[model samples]
Target: MSHQTGIKANEKLIKVFGKSKNGKLRVIKVSIENEELNCTATAEVKKDWERDYDKLIVPLIEESVPCYILYRLDSKTSLGYAWLLLSWVPDTATIRQKMVYASTKATLKNEFGSSHITEELHATNKEETTFDGYIRHKQDFAAPAPLTSREEELVELRKKEINTEINTDTRHQTLGGVTCPMSDATVAAIKDILNGTYDYLQFRIDLEEERIHVSKAAVVPLNELPRQVPTESARYHLYLFKHTYDGNYQESFVFIYSMPGYNCSVRERMLYSSCKAPFLDDLNALGVNVMKKLEIDSGAELTEDFLHDELHPKKFVNSRPAFAKPKGPPNRGPKRLTRPQEQSF
Candidate 1:
C-alpha cells in the first residue's frame, strides 16, 4: 500500500504547485518520517540553476537515507509546468526504506498533480544523482535495443499465455467454476452428516479435475476433531457438536475451515478460500444449519474447549461490590448551658 503525505508536506506542496509563489522554487526534497512523507528541504532557482543541482539536491540524500526530489523542468506544457520526480533510494538503505519509497512515489506525484510530472528518474547511488546521469537514464529509455526474431516470438507467446490465463479464469469464474463443483460423493457425505450417520465431514479440491471431493467422513468425537484435520493442506470440516451446556443437552452443526499455514501453496490457499462460502451454501441448502463457523490456521487449535468457548462464550458478571449509601448521623440530645463567674478585684 502507498503511504500518505504529512500535513507539512501537503502545505508545502500547495505553495510549490500553486500560483502564489513569488520566489523561484526550483527543487523540493521530500523525506519519509513516521511512515509519512514530509518536505525536508527546498531550493530556489538561482542564476546558474544547472550548475547548482548537485549542491542543492545531493546534500539532502545520504548513503542510507531514501528521499524524493521534485525538480521543476524548464519545459512547460499546455497542462502546467513540467516537473521531474527523482526517486533516490540508495543501495545502502534498509529494505523497509526501499519499499516505503517505492510505494509512496506514486502518491507523491498524484498529490502534486500527475500531469505536471513529465518524467521520473530513479537513482540508487551518488553518481546517478548528477545531471549527466539523469540525461543518460533518459536516453536509455528513449531508445531501447531492438529484439531478435526469436525474442519477438517469445514475447508474443508470453502475452498470449497471460491473456489466455486471464480469459480462462474469467470464463470459469463467470460460469461458477472457480469454486469447483461438488462431486456426487461429496454431496452424499454432506447428506450423511445432516442425517447423523456421520459426525464429521471434510472436503478437498481436486485441482486437476476442478471438483470438490469428500476426503474424510466418519464419526469423529469432539476431542478428536483436531486429529481429523489435514496437517499439510486446506480442508473444510463440518462437525456435529453434541454437548450438554448448563444441564441442557445441545446439538449444533459447526463448520470449521482449517489451513496448514504458509506451508500450503498460494494457489491452494486461494482455491480453498474461494470455494469456502459456496461450499457452506451447498451444505445449508441441503438442510445442514451450521450454528457456528470457525477459521483456524492449525488443526491443533480445534480442541473441544476452543469450540465450547466459541459456541458459548463465557459471560462476565460484574462481581465487584455495589456502592452503599452512608447513614446519617444519629440525632443528639440538647446540651446544658453554663454561665462564667465574674472575678473580684
Candidate 2:
C-alpha cells in the first residue's frame, strides 16, 4: 500500500511563515495537533542566527515529543531565504509519532517551498540538536579533499576489483551464488534439510545489510506448509513433500516463493526478485533437484492440494474404442426367385 500523507500544514502556519522575515522569527516549531501540522511555538532572533541556537531553540524541545524545527540561517538562498529543516524525532517518542513525522516530512517541505530549505538535519538526541552537532553533520556529508598520486592509484585498483567482481560471478565456499551471503546458521539449516533431518526451511533477507538468514527450519508436514509462511513479509521456502503418487511413496522437493504483495515495499520486491534465480541455481549446484517451483502472493494458497496439483497433473485419455464394420448376412443360396406376382393391377 502507498503511504498516505496524513498530516497537512495549517493555515496559521502559512500566515506565520509569510511574515517570518520581517518578524525576526529565527525558528518555528511545527507539530502534529488534530492530525494537522500547526505552529506550536517560535523563536525570535535576539542578536543573530547563531546566538539563538542555544538561547531560543534549546528550551522548546520536549523529551518524548517529536517535532520539526524550521531554522532560518544567516546564509541567503536564491529564493531570498535560507532555512534548515531540523527533524527532531527523539528516540523516546512513540512509534506512531515517529512514523507520522517521517512520512509527513516531504509533504511539509513541499507545502512550504522546498527551494528555501538549504539544508536538512535529522536528530534523535538532544546533543545532536546543538550548534556543534550541526557543524559535525555538515562535515560528514562534505566533499572529500583531493587525493595524492599514490592514493589515486589505490582507489583505481579498488574500483577495478569491484567491477571485476560484479562482472564475474564469484562463488564463495560458504554461500555459493547469492550476492547477499547467507549466515552460517542458514547454511547449516540448509544442510539439515538436504540430510532429511528437516522437511521445511524458511529464509528472510536483511534488506539494509544485504544478507540472507534462516528464519525457520523444521520437519513440517505437507498440510502445514501454508502455516509456515509469514503474512507480513516476503520469504523463501523449501519444502520436502512426502506423499503417495500412483500407489508408490515419493519425496519431492518444492521451492516456494511467498510474497505478501501489498504488505511488502518496492525495495523488498526488487531485492527478493534479484535473489530468487541465483538462490535456485545455488540449490541446484548443491544437488537439490527441485521438482516443482511455486510462487504465491499469500500463505493461504500454499495448501496440500495446491502442491499436489502442481506436482502431479491429471492426464486425459480416449475411453471410446475405434469403430469397425459389422459382418454381412451369410448367403445360403443364390436367390429365392420369388417374383411377386406383378402387382395384380
What TM-score does each of the candidates earn? 0.44, 0.48
Clash number for every model? 0, 0
Tens-place lDDT digits, model 1, residues 1-345:
123323234565566556413337788888878655677788787655567677777777777788889887666788756778889987566544655676677778766778888888998788898988887888888896766556755653453342345554452443232447887767777877777788888777875466787766678777777777777888888889998899999999999888888777655666777678877777888899999998998778987788889999999998999899986668865666989999999
The models' CA-based lDDT, in order, is 0.74, 0.79
**What lDDT tens digits, residue by residue, belong to model 2 across residues 1-345?**
224456788899988878775638888999988989899998777777887787777888888899999988888866776899999988666545766787789888877778889999998799989898888899977959756556755653453343334234553322222356776666777787899888888888987666787766677776766777778889999999888898999999999999988677666666676688778886787778899998998878877778888999988797888888986679765656676677765
Candidate 2 residue-wise lDDT at 69: 92
How far is each candidate from the true structure, as Cα RMSD in Å?
Answer: 26.1, 13.6
In candidate 2, list every pair of residues with a backbone clash: none
| Model 1 vs. true fold: TM | 0.44
